[model samples]
Target: MNEAPNRNRPAREVIAGDRRYVWHPFTQHGTEGEPTVIARAKAATLFDADGTEILDLVSSWWTCTHGHAHPKLNAALAKQAAEFEHVMFAGFTHAPAVDLAERLVRLLPGDLSRVFFSDDGSTSVEVALKIAYQYWINRGEPRRTLLLAFDGGYHGDTLGAMSVGRGSQMFKPFRDLMCQVLVLPYPATFEGDDAVEEREAGALSAFQALLAERGQSIAAMIIEPLLQGAGGMRVCRPSFLKRLVETAQAFGVIVIFDEVMTGFGRTGTLFALEQADVVPDLVCLSKGLTAGYMPMAVTVAREAIFEAFLGESFDRALPHGHSFTANPLACAVACASLDLFEEEKTLERIQAINLRHRELLAELQRRSDVTRPRVLGSIVAFDVKDIGAYQSDESRKLKAWYLAHGLNIRPLGSTLYLMPPYCITDEEMSRAYAGLIEGLDSLKR
Candidate 1:
């Protein structure tokens, strides 16, 4: 079990030793061990120690929006490191943090102005949940204890996030410790799905009934905006989201959009809320927030919501603060990443990916092994026939097959999805889609 960490060690050796010490997220280590060790990464490609170029079709877990180690972001991180790495965000403020917050507020919809910082997606979600929960409590409504979330919604793994994401089924072990979050059916639709209206009506009716019953006690309702990423990339209609927002607002429920996986031009727009025309009371952002250069998360809320916590008493203030909150290095990289969105024309590239996704989705439907074909922005996904479920033997075999083909495509249950970086070339994307077709064909009879 003594694997050397140098340029000479084999990739397999490093990978094998990783099993002995490292524990991966969302993985059962008892059965799944020796995870692949990526030595280096560039735009749309990861290189193992042995130098196998693995195509990153999932954007490195849906974070690297502009691509891996983007030059601008790298430079930003280096510059910030020389100046200041991190400082306690409680009483101190930095240029990168303040500038990034201002930039983000300008880009987001409506007057969502107050930005609270954290370290990752889960904490961002936790911040939003806590803020909303306490906002009502501070306003003399401590009884508003209930939270609302969609059936397939996934926020994060923290306790507060876990409560809202109870429907995701990834928290079975800690189920007893988690709080209650009311689940409403997610009315998902894909290309050429004509029954969407009926499904939306059913969902709306369910939500209306829930609001009619427990709407007063509800603190907030957190959503994935347009596409629910971890919940099998389930996509909801924009009109349905608008109606839901209106209904929640009418009932005085704080609407929160968990844009952790959908923010920063991943959905062919700056944010998914741009397409829906609905402003949320709070928005959770992370993942691509720093364009994969650093880990940072933000919970942006409306001014009035922030005002609710503005009393001289410490009890009225939100009791959340991370040591690396508003980290200068992360903020600097995020600002650079934002620049790439303009200078590099990232939106145009994403639009091209959207076109390619549509074309590939149509071709994917022609295959006999794919089912439930769906496309949202640059993301295209379908269920493979043989892969039964997330923890099934067949699922592991399918994932291994993709790895053997030098593609890092992390599947969700039987669902095979692609969310390549915005910098992915047409040739690379074509190769990935072709690999998916081949993987599907291999699983066939």
Candidate 2:
């Protein structure tokens, strides 16, 4: 087909084409620079077409679990592709999908036994929201119309996901189109913050009062357990999550844990819910599901919720399906990625990362420019003092500084954070931290 459109085009030509045609996500193309052209990646390093090796610190947007081009994951994808690429998932069932479902059922907590495959994190959340809304209708209680979400919790970019994540400040243009959601205060905490207990108590009190006022009319209460990713890497205590779940359960409110970012060993556990010792009615999982190799997500539901959607009439069934719902390649890669968790002792790696994070954050804490240092599992974040806004000058400067130093890091507003891949070596991590220190030092200048 026309020589496959020149497989070996120059990097400049590719960048020119992108400038002409590409519309990047959450990007202001008018003001932003050219996108970095990554030609290849290995382990935790990405190589640009110009032969520059960039250390991946954000896990390529918090997706790469076992790192880029992992041998085992690559082999799994190759084996599946050799057999079959893809088939419509509506009526067709494949071994890879079934095996993934079985493994997820075993790995997930509580009664999250039913897995509904979707394309990405947003769709997984959309599926969960739809299920939650329809479950009450199937149960003959269609009055549960309101949805609740914690402030600063971001689910995804889709409409339904955006509706719950409205407070995340990315959906202002589509605010009128979004459904009304009751937003609760988030008890975000940091190291050496003595007021955390007070904040937690105040948040709980507010939630309890809200439940007392409008618990019956609520359909579901969704949150990003432990860590809120896009909302600036804000972390809460596991005890707060447990208490929140208990309060929601007491009010007969369905709880949804949007574990899209915190799942699959990122949180030093299989899932964030496990650390909290809480079981949610529905959970949205993606991002690291396929170790960032393939686009896949699953909205896992409790058996009770699944049962509500089953009936004699087709009207009662949850009507949702994507053409590539459980793509064979994605399923195979996800299964392989999950296998890596056990074989490679991924949780232990995450724990080690946490220790390093604490050490690095402690050093950063001494800097006057850094504030509110927080660590949860593999995530570590701190806010820059007196930064303007989300796309502040200081934030952009720091990002450019990191890239110039051969490190990849994207700051969320004033929040500078790192969510490195599990395969990152000690030296790589030290390099990343050194870059961070240099960037912070530049802020003083």
Candidate 3:
């Protein structure tokens, strides 16, 4: 009985094995179509089992900042693996993690000097949530358990993250189990948005009322900064963010900026907080932290907030950490990715992407099918009109059509968006926009 004669031999076998046992994240296997098996990938392009090249428009869920399999990051990962793969991070320190932490501190704003390692975006949010809760408790305010977040903001899928991301509709089944989190209106704005003042005032009034009533009870206020990614890529003004921070701070509520999606030059700055000149008490960062090369996240806090958790007694200190905390390989790749920001001028490339997106938005405005067009740095999005399905069937149809025509785009309900890798070429961008227009035309007929 030698394992049924070892029949598993080919690529198809591997794929079949995946289909048999693998349960994918954020996907419906019963109703939705089968997953496309990717074989190899490179900068801005992914190859399927049949070697069909698909231009990654959404950057594989808005990661892959420099692109897939970037040489520098790959080399760094290999070097680090050869030297030291991983080490338990409780008492030991590694050069890669330490250097990466130092680099992040310099890049971030204000006194966000302390970094706590984690595995992904959800854990990062969890870390921030825990830190904020304990920071108040450590300072002798154990009654402050209320957490505040914006409407239409999607944090992550963990219990704490989902509590803050109630507006995203991703956790309907577990709605009853999440902790208490208050949702405030988000003043989402776009091009030629003159009603922002009114919306901001209304939001401020609501926030003020909430703070006045529960200001002493609230532990922290977390936000997605200038852009809400999973909530239809809804962007707000920098002034709105600044004002929101000020309002939260005035209430003595700890401020946590969920920069998981907007970090690493996605919003025309290294960090979205820099664009608004706002200093949050804690910042949750992931996504492009390793330039999409590895899974890593950091919850960095201001010195004052970090100090709240310090004490001689074990019970007084924060006792949360992941097994893979500060994994050396992830840290090494992250360091290399940061280096590319300076060596390859990544932010400048983002500016070029932004310019192109602006030009595309101007042209897209002429098309009747496109509505509420918005462009933020490398991200461009618009809703397709008269598609009947909107966020449901229409979005699926448009996505399938795009895939058939050699593109990878995942639309949010009625919204079609493009957040291509920074290494995407001008010709590719033009082709992607052209394909989108063609999809809209087909939908019209």
Best by TM-score: 2
Superior candidate under lDDT, 2 versus 3:
2
lDDT (10s digit) by residue, model 1, range 118-153: 999999999998999999989999999889998878
lDDT of 2 by residue, 1-445 (tens): 1212224878889999999999998899989988888878889998888778899999988999899999999999999999999999876899999999999999987888999999999999999999999999999999998999989989998898999999787788999889979999998998899999999999999999999998889999999999999999999999999999999999999999999999998878889999899999999999899999889999999999999988799999999999889999999999999899989999999999999998997788788878999988888899988565688887888788889889998889988899999999999999999988887777778
Clashes of 3: 1
In the order shown, the candidates' Cα RMSDs to the true structure are 2.6, 2.7, 3.8
User: RMSD in Å for candidate 3, one decimal?
Assistant: 3.8
lDDT at position 251, candidate 2: 91
Clashing pairs in 2: none
> Can you give the lDDT of residue 313 in candidate 3?
89
lDDT for position 274 in model 2: 92
**TM of each candidate vs. truth:** 0.97, 0.97, 0.96
Instruction: Give me candidate 1's TM-score against the actual structure.
Output: 0.97
Once model 3 is optimally superposed onto the true structure by TM-score, how far is the C-alpha of residue 389 displaced, in angstroms?
A: 7.5
Residues 1-445, candidate 3, lDDT per residue (tens digit)? Answer: 1212123345577668878999988777776776777777889998876677899999998779999999999999999999989999988999999999999999887899999999999999999999999988899999999999889899999999999999777789999999999999999888877898999989989999999998999999989988999888898989988988998898889999999999998988999998789899999999899998788999999999888877788887778988899999999999999999999999999999999999888989998777788888889987677654334777788789999999998788777889999999999989988997887777766
| Candidate 1: 10-residue stretch with minimal lDDT | 1-10
